[model samples]
Target chain A: AQSVTQLDSQVPVFEEAPVELRCNYSSSVSVYLFWYVQYPNQGLQLLLKYLSGSTLVKGINGFEAEFNKSQTSFHLRKPSVHISDTAEYFCAVTPTGFQKLVFGTGTRLLVSP
Target chain B: EAGVAQSPRYKIIEKRQSVAFWCNPISGHATLYWYQQILGQGPKLLIQFQNNGVVDDSQLPKDRFSAERLKGVDSTLKIQPAKLEDSAVYLCASSVGLAGGPPRETQYFGPGTRLLVL
Candidate 1:
């Protein structure tokens, strides 16, 4: 079984400021990592994924994440944020051969003006 | 491409009542999944289907929840005698079910059905 942990339950940042949401996972086998975002009353949208190679993965809305295998972390980062970036973020993991994803509780990012 | 679709954007029911939700996966998608998301929590996989056959359902509360995919296209999930804890958002997701394929890792999700049990 696989599990994900998001250290922060909520984060507040001013517009144009940088931010990082921490995520860590536990699994016995190799796994794939992903970050997803959900706006109020909307479904989740994929931010980025780390299947293999190039630990630094770029995603939409100028967001990126670094996959640190040794640390078992896949933290999402953004150099600059906007008010519209406020949303709920989730970190998910699945084993190499399976598609069942285990997700973190969530991190609510509130980008303020 | 059209994304996954789920019906009844919102539903409210009393305890001990029955409720059903429907889902339509993306065209050409072979894998469908049902997930439950409690308030302020991440979505948890309840069941997964690969072309009308169940691939995984280890987390589902089988005593009160049941789901089915017919003709490998659409699916329905039913809960009998709903409990207060059953109040949550039900999400439907779909992905290509090819083993050992690259893009199979991505799963598109629907808007989800919000169920509020009183």
Candidate 2:
């Protein structure tokens, strides 16, 4: 079985400021990682994913994540966040050969003006 | 392309009542998924369907929950004698499932149906 941990329950940031949401996972086999965002009253949307090659993966809305194999981390980062970036972010993991995704609790990104 | 679609964006029912949710996945998508999202928590997979056939339903509570996708395109999930704990957002997602391809396809999600049990 696989599990995900998002230590931060909430992250507060000012508009145009840099932000990073941490995500870590535990899996015995190689896995694919993904980050999804959910706005108020909306469903989860894929932000980015890390499957194979290139440890650094970029996503929509100028967001990006770096897959640190040794650290077991796939932290989402944005150079400058906008007010619209305020949403709930979820991290998910699935084994390389499987399609069942295990998700983390989620991190609420609060972007203020 | 259109994303996934779910019905009754918001539903409120009393405890022990029965509720059902409808979902229509993207055209041509062979895989569909149902997830439950509680407040302040990430979405949890309740079931996965591969073209009208169930692939996984291990986490679903069979005593109260039941789901079916008879046509391989649309699906319905039902909860009988619901409990307060069943109050959550039910999300429907779909992804392209090509035979002999990697299983890492990106899943597209619907707006979800919010179920509140009073």
Candidate 3:
């Protein structure tokens, strides 16, 4: 079975500041990684995904993540954040041959003015 | 394109009562999934359907929770004799199915139904 870990429960940052949400996974086989964001009352929206190419994956809203195989990490980063970027972020993974998507607890990004 | 759709944004029911939630996947999506999300936790897949056929349901509480995706488009999930622990958000998501890709297809999600068990 595959599992995801998001060490930080919450990350507070000011507007226009850089931020990074850490994520790690454990899997016996190769896997795919993804980052999703959820607004207050909406469902999750895909921020980006890492399937097979380019360890550095860029996503919408100026967000990006790096797939570090040796470190088993896929950390999401943004050069600058806006107040509207405040939302719950999630990291998910699925094995190369499986269909089940395992998600981390979540990291709430709180952006202040 | 329209995303996944779910009905009854919020529902309140007492323990031992029954309630049901509805979901409609994207027009051409062949795979649908139902997930339960507790407060402060990530969503957990309770059941998965591939064109009206059961694909995986190992985590579902079969004794009280049941779900069906009829016609391979719309689906309904029901919980009988609800428990206080059942108070959580129920999310519905859909993907292009195995034919599109394996472990790579993006799963679009719905607004989710918030169930409150008192």
Summarize candidate 2's per-residue lDDT along A1-113 as a digit string, tens digits.
Answer: 99999999999999999999999999999999999999998988999999899999999999999999999999999999999999999999998878689999999999999
**In candidate 2, which residue pairs get closer than 3 Å at backbone N, Cα or C atoms, i.e. clash?**
none
> Candidate 2 at B4: error in angstroms?
1.1
- Candidate 2 chain A: 10-residue stretch with minimal lDDT: A94-103
Q: Whose TM-score is higher: candidate 2's or candidate 3's?
A: 3
TM-score of each: 0.97, 0.98, 0.98
User: What order do you get sorting by TM-score, best first?
Assistant: 3, 2, 1
Cα error, residue B78 of model 1, in Å, equals 0.4
Task: Using lDDT, rank the candidates from best to worst.
Answer: 3, 1, 2
Q: By TM-score, who's the top model here?
A: 3
Whose DockQ is greatest here? 3
In order, the candidates keep a fraction of the true contacts of 0.59, 0.80, 0.84
Query: Could you give the interface RMSD of candidate 1 in angstroms?
Result: 2.1
lDDT of 1 at A82: 98
Give each model's whole-structure lDDT. Answer: 0.94, 0.93, 0.95
